[model samples]
Target: MPDEVIDCRGQRCPLPVIAAARRMPEVPVGTVVRVLADDPAAAVDIPAWCRMRGQEFLGSVDGPDGPAYDVRRTH
Candidate 1:
């Protein structure tokens, strides 16, 4: 399970990514942050954000409302 779960459902493209970015810094390194987003852009953006931010993208899974993207804090 993720150490943190950010719900971005009903939000649009950049909002989901923005929320993840905002929350990621609060978690400890090596902890997993799960982003629950319904926006289709999240599928692409989250992974891309991980790459750009130098974090570890742990892929995604289906959630109750949408897909949940997992990212581990590497720094």
Candidate 2:
């Protein structure tokens, strides 16, 4: 299935994290989510959030717009 993508550019710390959290429930378990962010702190924050939430942090990459992360939720 096609994963959902959340573009959180220009948003700050908690907002980016919050946006991801909001959509995460809709993603279902085992599916991936691509979070595109450019807040600089997202690199650290996103991973940490994923860890705390028991999600899979598949890693991140530099996309054309900014940084993108591959996250998978596990129930």
Candidate 3:
């Protein structure tokens, strides 16, 4: 389970990534933050965001609405 779950289901491209960026800093390092996004762009953007931000992308899983992207805060 993730330490935090950010719901970006109805949001578009940059919003999901933006929400993650805004909220990730509040979580403790080594904890997981899950972003629930329905936008197709999330599939690509999430992992890229993780790479660019130096966080660990733990991959994603199917959710009721969309995919749940798991990110481990490394810093």
Candidate 4:
């Protein structure tokens, strides 16, 4: 489970990552951001975004709607 959840279902590439980034600063280190995305590309892009941004890609969680990207704030 994550500290905060960013629902990006139906959203494409950059939106999911962008939304997550917006809320990343709100949490402390070691906390995770759960990004719910229906876009299939998000499976790879979200983790890539986290890596490019210096965050930790904690991995994925499956939901009824879609998969969630568990990203931990490292910076």
Q: Pick the candidate with the highest TM-score.
A: 1
Q: Write the per-residue lDDT of candidate 2 for residues 21-58, one digit (tens) a residue.
A: 99888877988888888888889999999999998889
Q: Please list the C-alpha lDDT of all candidates, in the order they appear.
A: 0.92, 0.86, 0.92, 0.87
- Candidate 1 RMSD computed on C-alpha atoms after optimal superposition onto the true structure: 0.8
Tens digit of lDDT per residue, candidate 3, span 2-73?
887888989999999999999888888998989999999999999999999899999999968578899999
- Output the TM-score of candidate 3: 0.94
For candidate 1, give the lDDT of residue 65: 55
Considering TM-score, which of the candidate structures 2 and 4 is the better prediction for this target? Answer: 2
TM-score between model 4 and native: 0.89
Cα RMSD for candidates in order? 0.8, 1.6, 0.9, 1.1
All candidates: TM-score: 0.94, 0.91, 0.94, 0.89
Q: On residues 18-68, what C-alpha lDDT tens digit does candidate 4 reach at each position?
A: 898888888898898899998888998888888789999988988785788
* lDDT-superior candidate, 3 or 4: 3
Model 2 RMSD vs true structure:
1.6
lDDT of 4: 0.87
Error of 3 at 19 (Å): 0.3
- Candidate 3: count of backbone clashes, pairs at least 3 residues apart or interchain: 0
Query: Model 4, residue 2: what's the lDDT?
Result: 84
Model 3, global lDDT: 0.92
Q: Which pairs clash in the backbone of model 3? A: none
Q: Positional deviation of 70 in candidate 1, in angstroms? A: 0.3
